[model samples]
Target chain A: MTHILLRHRDIPDINTLNVYKKNGGFAAFKKAVTKMKPAEVTEVVKNSGLRGRGGAGFPTGMKWAFIDKNNWPHYVVANADESEPGTFKDREIMEGNPFQFLEGVAIASYAIGANAAYVYLRGEFWELAAFLDEKIAEMEEAGYLGEDLFGTDYSLKIYTHLGAGAYICGEETALLESLEGKRGQPRVRPPFPPSYGLYGKPTIVNNVETLTNVPLILANGADWYKSMGTVDSAGVKIFSLSGRVRKPGNYELPFGTTFRQLIYEYGMGIQEGRPVKAIMPAGASSSLIAVDDKVLDTPMDYAAVRTLGADLGSASVIVLDDTVSMDWVVNKTIHFFKHESCGKCTTCREGNYWMRNLTERIHSGKGTGADVDLLLNVAKQMQGKCLCALGEFSTMAVVTGIERFPQDFKQAVRSNS
Target chain B: MSLEKKYPKEVKQLLAKYPPEHKRSAVMPLLYLAQREEGYITREAMQDIARILEITETEVASIVGFYTLYHDKKEGKYRMQVCTDLPCALRGADEFLDNLCANLGIKVGETTEDGLVTLESVMCLAACDRAPMFQTQGPRRHQVSRVHDRGPHHGIGRGVEEE
Candidate 1:
């Protein structure tokens, strides 16, 4: 099947403006700006049932409609900070099918009545940002961006902002703070970005992949998109397949594609034909899913994966084979979260630090069985206390690893007896 | 020597990205500009940026301290950050990093004797498929080097030569 999000795979040179235009790029944005009312655009998207691809799985159209109508000079900030551990799909989309993603940004801006938009890319993506800056300029020159877009009073200007390395900034509130030139730490939630964001104004913060789905939804009606993926997940998703796989790369498959198909078929089975032991369905943030035949055969979707006690977050399926152990895996994830905790909330900052120490001790075979129990207790304590999801995500691997793979931890820790 | 006198055009363009009232938002890109010359943000550059954005010097310094990319000390002309996170480590990124450090005769977070490259182990860079991959932050640009196909030695040699 031809790619919807990763369109560049099907058509080469799609990164070039002329080539993209030839293949029907920006037509959706043009149609939305010239003909449809902003409310109508939101209504279509609402019917389509597209969810944010940035792990949270929040409804996209509802988010756009939440923009405070009373507020003036609304803004749209694209969360291009694709810093998740096994996730590389957004980078590919931005680098390959950039025009499509940018057009999605344009359509989103029109729907939310945002006049200015910002694409917050992680600092590591410097080259990609420069590439996208050129794309934005091309859109401006072609009259798809800048003042009076498509000969309508609804004008839009999109800018690209670079974030210095901070994983916590991927959180929408923290992203807004970083975009405002403050330290990238998440804000207290009662007032989310829609009500108060980016300089205390109503802003719609959409993920790069989520925004990329907009133009296509606007061009082809809602039902066309709803028809593709499962009932719960109503569109194709780019599964970032990695770890212990022969073909570890981005696979843009429709939702409800079974894990067996993604891992064995597209991913070409585990590396060296090893039997699959586990799966980190959402990178390091996932609760490690113990892979039995039933788990492997399960359909990959937001709700379906939940039945297996995991979210198919961002669909970054990191396959783990028998060669790997859950103890070592938990250590790696704890280290990542510890380094990226942002020190905003005491719970996350201190919890990750302690978890890192415990995991290090456990993995290095320096800890007793009591240390394993203590680690699990600490992780469970930190589950719901964080100001943002980062802290909660930090505990997923720890709690799940200890509960599901007791033998791994039992072997990892030295016996006190 | 200062950012304003060194690159007036770049500074002006950075400030123009945000609104006049919120020019403080230009602090990040401005800090990047300031770091362009010395490979790290200097004391004077921070002051200059603080003045440019009308933010306090502590505000500017706090940003550099908080984010990993912005450095205060001048260690090397090129910062070679290797991702040894879980996904990359699965593909021998840890072994690759250890080998590269051995080849350079410097440990991770240590700069070469010639002050040319500083080696650092970073978290996942989102390029998990391309394991043993790294990004080089030079005085001018950040370039991601994928050495999955080629060995680490070859990729490191190619990276140092190109930069």
Candidate 2:
């Protein structure tokens, strides 16, 4: 039960240099620079099976490997824009254990042979960004960062970039656009960040939680790191539990920890002891899973959530009780995606607007069965056609709500009539 | 200072995006710069921006008027934007707004008569869980300077409270 990915949760004040160093922090960077090669570091991460915690569970090592070596002066951009509803794990890590996060960024940059790295944070994280800047300066003073780190030729300088309060910037490409001082919108894929990113240079973008695991991966070795969680999804994850929970906060557990243990044991069950109706396992963007015993017992991980028809995105588990309405939940989520839509792509821009109108009508009791069907069709059409996951993700709640909680919509429609 | 001289570098760089004959492509960045300097785009500033961009005053005005982020009128020293979207609203943003209005001694869409603060409701600010949050945009350390400058211009605006 030792913490792997989220070791800082157990260690006190890991944000401080002394506390962090005491807990075997930056030893990874020292070892990686002095002993291991860049490719070897990436191979360790790849072998450990660490995936991106930023909704898209992409392999971290594969993302680094994808960087076009032909493109010189490659960049590393950490997606710290944790704007997904019910997601606050990154915020906690950045605020509570900043040094570890910074060291992770440094290690990732070193592993990918990136001389410069940027942590693109949400605008609300202005304070966190400033704090991180101070931490980066501290790292520089400690000789863990900057040119000739630990007497090697590997030079890395980490910078913190702020997004202008756009959720779309959480998308890797969109993050690059914002970092380049443009509007926060997603660029077309196929030439992903690894090929062409900030300023059209090869870039590797990793999530905050994903990079935070790097220090441990190097400190403990691949097998030791992989031993904590399920086979496919190794290491501990910080599940940000919120909404109607008596003891709502972040709970660090190994991946594949059951939803029941998280909700009841960690979250202390519902606030008023109300029956748990549904669980949005991955924030507003996740499909609403009916909180039956089966789902409660289902382990919390990428593959486990897949069996329940959802992804363990960011592991932002929002527990909903019977008092909350599914229609209302869908309406809230729709409103968010609609407002945050950068309007760069035709489908997400127009489709989200259309879906919002339908969700509002349905939730307000003004919608009919045909309206519901049309909403579903619009969401379906919007899938696979978006320039980024924001567009594709906007559909999860809508599709799942209608499919799993039809009675709620029917009741809302009936009430309106 | 004139808008052209204030942002000559930015204007020139942005203008290079278009052909010399099509200097109008720099209109957006010009307006953005103007607003950044003056806090809000006035009619005269818009006219100057249009002149620099080689576009009509009406074109500049229309573009400035379109985006809600761009203010056509003079904003108060502090601009408070509260998110009124569903997530925030459900989380008692309305009550928080009422409390804010009462505390600030002004209603929504109205600036304090002394111009200390302009209050407006935004559609969303992207932070749902941190609901009932409002952003105060102005010089973070110039509250005294702003109050003293506007104290003689007008008295405080009317305070409306909903019971």
Candidate 3:
């Protein structure tokens, strides 16, 4: 299939505004602003079953519909803060096919009646941020952005905001806090972003990938997108294939593509053709799925992966071969979570601290079988208690690793003598 | 000299990006500018940023403390950050980091006698596809910043981020 989101793969130089406009770049956004009503633009997106690509598969259109209309001065913030370990698809999209993503951002702002939008990029992308700034300037010059866009009374301006290294800032609320020039930490729920966000205004915080889909959904009708993937999961997704794969990068496959296809056909099989041992489908946040024929053949969709006791959060498929030890893998991931735990809540901050110690001990042959159980217990304790998904997610691999790959722990714990 | 004086145009543009009332939003980028001269963030830079943004120096210092990129203390000429996160480690990033440190005759957190490189482990830089990869916090930012931690970005101005 031709690339929808990643047009750079299909069309070279789409990052340039001239090349993009020549290839129908901002046509949908222009159409929405010029011809369609703000609510009508939202209606078209609502009809399309585009879900949030930022881990949570919440329907994108429904999120836009939830925007509090009673509130004045709406805003839209693009989640370009792509910091999930093993997840790097968004970076390629922003770096290569930037205009499409920006076009999507512009469309969302028009739909939400937001005059201003911000792309919250991770600080490491300081260079990429500079590149995007130039692209934004080009769009503004081309009249796709800036005030009175497309001859409409409405005005839209986009800005790039760089976030200091905080994994927690990927969370919508935390992104909001970071944008407001404060420490990045997740706030409590109920007052979601659609209601209270970004200095307590009605804001629609969509992932860069999610917003990128808006232009396509508007250009090619909703059914065109919904017809591609499974009924429950519509549209194509960029599955970030990494680790032990012969070809490690992104595969823009429709949602129903099986794990077998992603690993073998797209990824070109495991590195050096070793037998696959386990898979972490959701980066560091996924439960270690002990791969078997059933799991391998399972379609890589939200519902299919969930049935196997793992959510396809962001589709960052980390393949593992028999040569790799699950215990060591857990230790690496635990270290990442430990360093990234926002410390806002005690459970995640302390629980990850405890798990990291246990994992280090177990990985180093200094722990006992009881210690493995205790690690699982610690992970369980941290679950359902974190202020955000990062805390609860830090436990997924630890708990699943111990449960599914028990032998790795037992061998590591056994006395060599 | 104050950071604003050294990079007047850059500081002015960054401050202009945000609202005049919301000048504090420029603090992070200004810190990036302030760190340009010294390898680490100096106390004076924080005060300069505070004065420019009208926020307290304590506020600017707290932000530096919160983010990993803005260093408080001085370090080697090059702060070579290797990502040994899950995916990177799966592709031999840990061994790569250890070997680089061993060759440099220093530990992960230690600097070489020449102060050319200081090895450190970062969570992730979102470049998992390129395993055994590390970002060099070059003194000149990106100019000298490469995988080996040399170039204009090798040992110069300040920068900032998480993976």
Candidate 4:
């Protein structure tokens, strides 16, 4: 089937404004602005059953609806900080089908009554930021953006903002803080971004993939999108296939695609034809899934993956074959989280630091079984204490690795004892 | 020199992106502008940015301190950040980094004798599929490169020779 969100996969030069225009690009934004009310546009999304692709799986329309109507000017900040280890789908979307994504941003701005929007890209994407800035300028010149878009009083402008380098900034609140030129640490939740964000104004922060779905959902009817994916998780998703696979790249498949199909059919199986040992459905933040016949055949959806004790987060499948060890995997994830802890809440800052020390000692063969147990205990202690998901996510691989792959830890610690 | 005095037009354009009352939001971009010429943010530039944004220098310095991209001290002309995170490591990024370090005769986070490139291992660059990829951050430029079998030394040598 032709790609839906990843339209560039099917069409040539879809990144170009002219080519994108010819292929029914801005028609959705034009239709929404000319024919429908903002609430009506949002209603269509509400019925479509679209969820945020940014791991949390929150309902997209519900997030848009939560914007404080009493507040003077709602804002839309696109979370383009695609910093997750195995996730590279958003980068492809922004580079390949930029107009479609920008059009989605436009439609979302119209839906939430946000005249101004910001795309917060990670600092390493400086070139991508320039590329997107050019795209935003192109939209402005075409009169699709700027004051009085589509000859309607509804004006819209989209700007690209760059985060210096902080994984925690992917959190919406922390993203807002970074956009505001503050340290990229997450904020306390009670007042989420929808109620209080970006200079204390009500804002809608949607992931690039989530907002990219907006224009398509608007162009095609809600039922068209709902028909693609499973009931619980509707529509197609770009699975970022990476690590130990023959063909590791972005595979835009429907939500229900199995791991077996992704790794074998799309990704062409593991490297060297080695047997698959485990899978990290998410990136470093994933629980290490001990691969079995049931898991290999299980449908890859949020709810279904939850049955296997993991969220199909951003759907970045990192295949680990038999050659790899779980101890090393846990160590790598710990170091990542420790480096990116943001040091805001004591739990995440200290927890990751301590976990890193334990994982290092355990992985380097300098620790006994006591250290392995201590590492598991430290990780468990950090589970419910973090101010943000980063802290909670830090312990996932560690806890899962110890519990599921006890033999790996036993072997790792055996050498030292 | 102050950022406003050096590039008045660029400074104005950066501040224009944010509202006048909330122009403090322009600090990150301004920090980038200040670091454009030197590849590392200087004290004077931070002060200049702090003055322009109406925030304290500490506020600006705190930002430089917090984010990894904004370095406060001088280093090589170019910073080559390699991703050795989990996915990349799974695909031989760790070995790639080790080989690059061996080729350079300097460990990670050290500048070459020529002072052209400073190698550093970083977190994921979101290009997991492209294992052994590295991004170069120099004055006014940041470029990500996929360093396959030929080794990154040739690329680094070419980059140095170009300078």
DockQ, all candidates in order: 0.75, 0.12, 0.59, 0.73
Docking class of 1: medium
> Considering TM-score, which of the candidate structures 3 and 4 is the better prediction for this target?
4
Off by over 4 Å in 2: A1-9, A415-417, B1-76, B79-114, B117-138, B141-163
What fraction of correct interface contacts does each candidate retain?
0.82, 0.04, 0.67, 0.80
Task: Please say which candidate is ahead in DockQ: 2 or 4.
Answer: 4
Which parts of model 4 have CA positions greater than 4 angstroms off? B140-155
lDDT string for model 2 (A132-200, tens) is 878888888988887887887889888776554677778888777666544666787778888998778
Output DockQ, candidate 1. 0.75
For model 1, the superposed segments whose C-alpha errors exceed 4 Å read A415-417, B142-151, B154-159
Q: For candidate 1, lDDT tens digit of each residue in B87-110?
A: 888888888887888888899999
Model 3, runs deviating above 4 Å: B141-163
Decreasing lDDT order of the candidates: 1, 4, 3, 2
Over A88-162, each residue of candidate 1 has an lDDT whose tens digit, in order, gives 989999989999999998888889898899999998888888889989998889999888776778888899999
For residue A380, give model 3's deviation from the true position in Å: 0.8
* Residue B125 lDDT in candidate 2: 44
Fnat computed for model 3:
0.67
